[model samples]
Target: MYMILKSMKKNKLRNLVIVVQLIFGIVILSNSLANYKYYISTREKAENASSSNVYEVSVENKADIFKVGEARDHQYISGEENQISTVYKIAKESKLVEKIGFEGLGCNSCQYTNEEENEGKFILKSKIKTIGIVEYSKELTEMYNFKMKSGMNFSQYYKSEKAEDVIPMLISPQLSKDNPIGSIVKLPGGGKKYKVIGVLDNSCPLLNELYNMGCLYKPNNGYFCVIGSLLTNKKTHLYIKLKDGVSKAEGKNDFDKKLGEKFETQFFGLDDMAETVTLPAPYAARYILFGIIILVLSSFGIINTVLSTILKRKKEFGTRIAVGATKAQIEKLVIGEFIIFFAFSAFIGLIIAKLISGQQAVWDFSVIGISIGIVFLILVISMIPAYFRMRKMNPVDLVHGR
Candidate 1:
């Protein structure tokens, strides 16, 4: 052990270079691991957040216009009757449709404020559903867990003894001013003042990212998968939560079989949410790109010191061989030194990788494993040839300073 330590100390630059390489590899691995973990976790949370026993019916009709553009061109089909109410009635009759409720579309009057306006108001303009407070449990809030900064989900909005008098409402925190919810929102038709019962959320950065996403995109977690739902003309983009261990495909299948022509609904999963989940090919490209950057920086010090050590030790090596040291033995000495140094360096590098990955929360265990594996692999490849040369030297000529 003492001899090994001394040998490493004598070659400070070489040891340091190898250590830096290990550190780089570990950092990459840790970050990757954490990122993957976040993705898997968030996706599962999204899937399981709701009861598996529950699903929704999106009425794709003029009365059920979910998108603003659809409503813009739509002329009401049935007169003197509530079209949405009628659709809800048919949907409720479907075998697959279980425990259905309706949330009436809000008027723009209730969506706009004295301070600012909400983009979600577009849906409100299209006509919306009104829900009973108790019925809201599975209706409005059972999707992704948006970190709540204030106010409960609109779960209890319509459930009450004062259902008539309780005009309570929930809006995104931004919709609130220094205190926007308590104030009445101006109605689009004018003269109607809707009471703002509460503000939504203003917590994690993850939530902010989700809020910015296009209607099609839902953040997988608080960090990336944010937009849990979207609305389209004649279609209600329902946010669904499957039971734990249920596949989105399976859930969609169940929905179709059960609903059966009552409504034309499209079921989308994580991949469908975006442009199909990305290829690891791109992930590999990222790894290669970032790895190249890290490796180049690491190689400079490593290459410089290794070459310097080889040059400086030429004489020592020549003498060792001339004194009848076997070629294999001489080679082993050179290779062995590097092997030990690299192992230590790789360990330290791994620690650094983990520390740096703290913020990312990506899982990178494989990266770390590969990195450590590569460190020794590179050492063996790099040092083996050098060892041969040192071993093949003509000691007598070398000693005479050839």
Candidate 2:
């Protein structure tokens, strides 16, 4: 190792070129791995939610219907509840649909007016926006395949026909991990208290984001049901999961045709089919393609640098061989030097990659292991050419400057 370092130092220009090339290669490799990991995670999240089989129908409302002259009337709220029930009913009636769910105020989270007064009098508090309190049911949970982290699903016993005891609610995975099951979460302004009957181990980005943003899942029913909110103008999102062996083609042909006509007849405002609202995978093919290009270019650069360095040091190998150094020793020295270079370049590259990759940069053991594996791979690829070249070298020919 000492000799290898000494030799690298002796050949400043060549080592500099190799180091620079390696730095570039390692940077590219680290970034590519990070991107690859991100894409893999995104794919997992999408698949976990069964996105391919699930479709979303956006329930928009006609603005003109609620408008009174220049301003919209707060008392004129309508359409969402009926539209939601109708969609659920149709999906339930459809043989192609396996499960259905709905989200009132399609946004992942929203503000709620909550105020509880003392002395049997109501005191109003300033309205505040909260996260993740989506209006959904057990069907919606099934549609998204939300796994329970702790406790059980909403009990049939707890699904009261009317708002009586505290409504059973499911919290996000993050919330579940932080809070205990059966814990009561108070709504904003101490309005309603929901018992955390279930915890959702979901990676759905939007849901997670809402949870992170302080949204707790509460029953979108009782006194606070979205229908009665001042923000009743917000739309509901209907989600449906098709049964296995049922294709989107069937949905387009039969379901879309009927749904479009029904909405038009009812004048419910939306015109597009459910398929139009398919959640796009956050990372696309271009990210994978660019990662591939970076890896290919980096590998090529490493291979070129290794082969050049070996050829440039042929005379040194010849001198070593003449001095009674065995073939194995020569090979060992060359491989060792390259390994050291690979480690140094990879380490520096990783540091730089993390510094520049912003919030996405991660330095966990898995990432470190991957970085080492990538450097080892580059070393192995470069060694093939170096090994063969060294095998052909002879003391007499090399000393004669051949």
Best by lDDT: 2
User: lDDT score of model 2?
Assistant: 0.53
Candidate 1 lDDT for residue 364: 55
Model 2 weakest 10-residue run by lDDT: 267-276
Error of 2 at 290 (Å): 4.5
| CA lDDT, candidate 2, residue 252 | 45
Worst 10 residues of 1 by lDDT: 222-231
lDDT of 2 at 264: 20
Q: What's the residue-level lDDT of 362 in candidate 2?
A: 35
Cα error, candidate 1, residue 157 (Å) = 24
User: What TM-score, computed on C-alpha atoms, does each candidate reach?
Assistant: 0.46, 0.61
| Candidate 2 lDDT tens digits, 227-343 | 111223343566677778987667545554545432321211111221111222223234434443554465566567667777787788778777887878878887887688777
